[model samples]
Target: MSQRNYRAAIVGTGAIAHAHAQALLGSGRAELVAVADVDARRAAEFAGKYGGPSTHAGLDDLLREEQVDVVHLCTPPQLHAPLAIACLEAGVTALVEKPPTLSLAEFDAVIEAERRSTAHVATVLQHRFGAGALRLRRLQEAGELGRPLLATCNTQWYRDEAYYAVPWRGTWESEGGGPTMGHGIHQFDLLFSVLGPWREVTAVAARQARPVDTEDVSLALVTFENGAVATIVNSVVSPRQTSQLRFDYERATVEVEHLYGYTDDDWTVTPAPGQEGVSELWAEGRTTTSSGHDGWLAAVFDALDRGEAPPVTAEDTRRTMEFIAALYASAFTGERVQAGQIAADSPFARRMDGTGAPWEKVRNP
Candidate 1:
């Protein structure tokens, strides 16, 4: 007997939703049966373009009409939590976009919703699904890389004023945060997955040169639970753009440089003086899966087929989300933040900027 194929739907017919549609079609494990968008024309156009899947004006209508096994919440950052909660309530899985929720408190609520339902919620941190990341993690877990010591995660991309003119491109209330939360999250999530949990974060954020309310640039010094120290830089004001991550282990230094997604060729493993053997191990069991929405969804589909929770589980993603919160907390508060420190009552838990960003005064005045 053939394995059962699942039915999937895309909730927002945006650019990212197209990626989800393509991935769903390519997976062979799922079929795109329906899509929903607030704009009727957009939904119809997306449906027509992608095999004429049924289209609806809203998620409620889609849920009411289609027997969807999973719903890809490709909407804006702010809509992720509510839509995901709704999916959970309907006993349907929700594969949400990154920065899963606007705040830690919002994420906790989504977790609660998941607990009450038979469904699960997974975030789209596609970087962790790449071949390079998978290989590094496998080697690191097997003690092939020795101990991790230092690392750097940098996302330096340029976005002009016209990009921020979209209204939702840069705002705490709408988009959740600046580049730290929106753009650089992929690199840092991969970092967190490889290094385990973080211990503390000291950071700073500035609007820099962007014509927006949120910071265009932010930097941080992070200490991991395993004693590895890493520096992070998130910026949208750089002239030249690149997304880079470097991990310096006792035996080897691994690095990948790419602007967006990465393949195996983008990665390099340089062994220590006496640990030249590490390079061969790095290239031995490699696959061609590049980091993107498709590869990540494939892993998610595998878990669903096994009646298991998805790869980027809520607990694992919460750690990364917490790190994001802590980065902003430390940046705006001018104090180092520790893991499990953003209590429900804390301002950072409610909002990324806590009471208000320090630069808010300068911008308002």
Candidate 2:
């Protein structure tokens, strides 16, 4: 039912890179063909740890050296665009990490590149395909959940001074933005996936937490194109580890919580008045998903096998980026940034340069 396995080449051997490589190895779906990084030593180190993936110092060399069918981009947000475009130019499909672009313009650039290149491209917004979300989709489609209404995304994650110690971790130039674009964005992706394309937004983002260059806290009021309004709160400064989406629909309410573990069973769907039997219908449509990152990689491979594109495309991610860019602009500029009103020329297009925001210093006692 499938063609031969597609070979794999990974870029950016960061912490998460190893996880992806390991998943690929474990899946038996693709071969570890090559790896590239700015630091040759790091590249070699990763290649060594894995199965001798060819190591390269940069993209130009890697693209020329490796016969990789797919490129897994594991770099920081700011680097995503150029590297992905280069991969496209080399006629390679790219599975990029979250926060697909630094700005809406860069997003358009990637989409344009994909349009022009021989390569079909996709991004990693992996949460939706999770077993929990998958079941939710089925339940909704089956009309067990009826018409969905309100949605809420809450992620209470914490990052301290140490987390930002890495040179690129907290910088606007390298990381794109703050937590709204980084730590909390995956959760945002999950929210958007379930809630659908959003309409107008009013948000406030702030960099009040650590020595970061972007906001650690953001609250947004967003309306969906379907006229459903949702409230979102994202932060890296909050204590307690939890993630949740509460979907209130016409027939029932469905919930998913706990980011790292569990599945559709985690959802407790409550049907509308006198519709108690809907719970059984929701439960009957159970599913299981590979770990979030693993599921995405597997899904990509599956799509490739099926001659279809990965579920999350550059255009899909661009919508998310557009909202995020608007969120940052709205919060940073103290204005209610308008969606669709934001163009490639909008201030959010480029990295936040020379904001003169102090690199918060912690007095070493």
Per-candidate clashes come to: 0, 0
- Give per-residue CA lDDT, model 2, range 1-365, as digits (tens): 56568788888999879878887898778898989899888898899999897888877888887788998899877788899999898889988887777767777888999999878778777776777777777667666666778988887788889989988887767777777777677777877887778888888766776876666778888888877788888888877878777889887787777755446556777788988987777667466654367777777888878877776877678778888877776665556766686765656765432123233322222
Note the Cα lDDT for every prediction shown.
0.92, 0.77
Models 1 onward score TM values of 0.98, 0.91
**Displacement of the residue 222 alpha carbon in candidate 1, Å:** 0.5
lDDT of 1 by residue, 293-328 (tens): 888988898888788899799999899889989999
Question: Per-residue error at 204 for model 1, in Å?
Answer: 0.4
lDDT, residue 227, candidate 1: 97
Clashing pairs in 1: none
